[model samples]
Target: MPRNYASLADQSVFPSISDLPGDYTCPETGGGVFGCLLVEIVSIERITRLVLRTFDRADSPVTVAFYTGDRGRSIENDPKLKPGNTMAILFPRRHLFLDGTVGVRQEHYGYFKV
Candidate 1:
């Protein structure tokens, strides 16, 4: 789906990739620690998962799982989601995982841009 970026231009405070803390789990963020990150696509896997890299750290790559119960199927179908493409993503509130990979379970299409 196409997006009207004008509507998305609110000055809502967004955290940088380096600012994402892993100490706690996201519990219905209410109004905290929200917003998407601008990241580069490092690699794609199985057409549904992705390995992404933040500009802040080349050594650290985050694995993104896009299986939010068909909520993310559009992401899997997007041709632009390939290596070297840049995209904006709002990960699920629980951005951190047990394996140390950070990713998305985004249920809203508005929060993701391909």
Candidate 2:
């Protein structure tokens, strides 16, 4: 069963993307470096899909979505999902190609229960 989106709270924070390693590189065939940070789940919504927005201490937001399936259940049941608790997220760094095209690598970071 789908969890109620109303159960989520609205608290925001700023994620420090700049703190991520700059030396991290992506592969030519396509895979990007991983960037990790501590964030709080601010808001959640279910509109045909599940959406979660996390924030850093500074109130910066990073939003992600999960479609129906095992992945969706995982997102809903994530242990770090409390409204105020801090959870670490690992995401891929944005890649800028020499050809002047920008891309983001798709990857999902799991949470460790604290």
Candidate 3:
């Protein structure tokens, strides 16, 4: 997996993440700003080239797991998923948030192509 700590920390587009908005929030957990902090997918070719970025930060040992969908299971697990496709990720944050912390919890949602 590729890490983008320097780029995420510097708020710049590095090899790790990109195409992030200036002010973005998690659609699910409403957490802090998420940039291209992760390396989501690698190409299926011989070199395993990458095509997607994640919201996870560098220095974080990450794993990319795949799931197969059974009929009538869930929208995400649909069997019609194509190769090099994208999906939305929603996660929560405890500290720094795009929205102020109060009764308002923080969550983030973004697309990761596989």
| Cα lDDT, all candidates | 0.54, 0.47, 0.30
lDDT, candidate 3, at 97: 27
Rank list by lDDT: 1, 2, 3
Q: Would you estimate the TM-scores of all the predictions?
A: 0.56, 0.47, 0.23
For candidate 3, write residues 31-83 as lDDT tens digits: 34553333333222112321122233342222232222222123334343333
Give per-residue lDDT, candidate 2, residue 43.
Answer: 73
Tens-digit per-residue lDDT, 40-90, candidate 2 = 767766554455566654565645454345445555665656577665545
| Model 2 C-alpha lDDT versus the unseen true structure | 0.47
- Clashing residue pairs in candidate 2, if any? 13-56, 13-59, 13-60, 14-56, 14-58, 14-59, 14-60
Error of 3 at 65 (Å): 1.8
Top model number, TM-score: 1
The clash numbers for all candidates, in the given order, read: 0, 7, 13
Native-referenced Cα lDDT, model 3: 0.30
